[model samples]
Target: MQNMGGIFGILGVGCGLYIFYALYKLKSTGDITSSILLPKDVNPKTCKDKDGYIKAVAPKMAILGISTIIYGLMDLCETFVMSTGNFFWIVLVLVFVVLIWFSVTVSKLNKTYF
Candidate 1:
């Protein structure tokens, strides 16, 4: 049981980082369009190029939220019994990093997917 918790924590961290990397790539390598999936700069400031940045951000944000919720579940499952010990920081950092990773990934993904 203890080992499972530790493994889950590490898995959370890894998943988070992978998602972030994917988003970063999306933001940097995509073609610009007037879709709400990416930032305004990709759409240009002209009327024909106008895209609702806020609208584009919704889906990506939702994905990030989903990721965070998953991460919280991972933490809760791991912490159910062994709530204290030397591995506290591992669990703490893992959860927090999961959030940061997903947020970054989502931001970039929104531009591409929206």
Candidate 2:
């Protein structure tokens, strides 16, 4: 179980970096609208300019990526702290809570922006 925490931490970091890279690509190409799966009520045509669309989406992407990175760091810290035989369960709970919060935030952003 302890080793698994480290693995998850590494995976989270990798996933977060990939998300950041995708956001960078979208911003550079000025094609954020096409990259996301927008809701039915939200039409891409509503966004008149490519720059504005990218600008709107970039912050959400950044928030998601940063939260993921923070989760990863917390996971790594939990792994080490567990080895010391202290506050293991508390840290684990915190990780799950953070993960849930991140998911909910992303879902809301998807509905609002995408």
Candidate 3:
């Protein structure tokens, strides 16, 4: 029941950290040759400026990672501290908004640089 939420929260945090780590690697290595951020049809070889693209997209990914961590904390709170009421719905909506924003921004970045 409510305890299940703790598991999900931990998983979310793990995922967020992993994403953050990936971005760090991309930034440090400047390796755009094989990036998950690149779209399927958008070839990295055709990118106008790989560094510029990463600079633009990395912040967006960071935002997404931070949002996921926040969502995870909220979920954990819902499981242990508070009851499943208004807060749950609000967090759910916020998660959706962040996800949609991330997707749209990434697509736009792909078009802008790739």
Candidate 4:
């Protein structure tokens, strides 16, 4: 179980870094028309200012990615040092909360931007 936490931490960090890199590339190129980050059916050309739209959304993606990395670190710490039963429940609850928050954020982004 503890090993799982470490694995998740590594995976989360890797995913977060990848997201950051992708967003950075999008920002640098000022091209929002065709990006892996956007939804499949979303046409960036529909937006009035594609560059501005990308610029606005990139920060949100960065924040989400950073939060994921932080959650992974917290999970790793909980696994190593807080394995008591009560602490376990607390961590589980925290995980659920994070999941819900992340889902809501993504949904909102989709609704607002995509």
Measured by TM-score, the strongest candidate is 3
Taking the tens digit of each residue's C-alpha lDDT, what string does model 2 give over 8-114? 87886787787788887887765443434354566655555556556655776776677667667667777765453445456546556755765576556555554
lDDT of each: 0.50, 0.64, 0.79, 0.64
Which is better, 2 or 3, measured by TM-score? 3
- Residue-level lDDT of model 1, residues 1-114, one tens digit each, is 564555674565565555555445435543233332345554333323223443454346446545644664556555674455545556456556755764577466554544
Q: What is the C-alpha RMSD of each candidate to the true structure, in Å?
A: 9.8, 4.8, 2.5, 4.1
Q: In model 1, which runs have C-alpha deviations exceeding 4 angstroms?
A: 31-114
Better model by lDDT, 1 or 2?
2
Ranking by TM-score: 3, 4, 2, 1
> Which of candidates 1 and 3 is the stronger one according to lDDT?
3
Q: What TM-score would you give candidate 2 relative to the actual structure?
A: 0.58
Instruction: Write candidate 4's Cα lDDT for 4-109 as tens digits.
Output: 7578767766766776787777688766524435567877656666665676667766766676666566666666766456654564566557557655765565
Tell me each candidate's TM-score: 0.36, 0.58, 0.80, 0.61
Q: Can you write out model 3's per-residue Cα lDDT over 1-114, one digit (the tens) per residue?
A: 574759988877786887788788879986663444775666667889878988898888888788888878878888888876887778768878988998888878887887
Record all residue pairs in model 4 with backbone atoms less than 3 Å apart, i.e. clashing. Answer: none
> Over 4 Å off in model 3, which ranges?
1-5, 32-36, 40-46
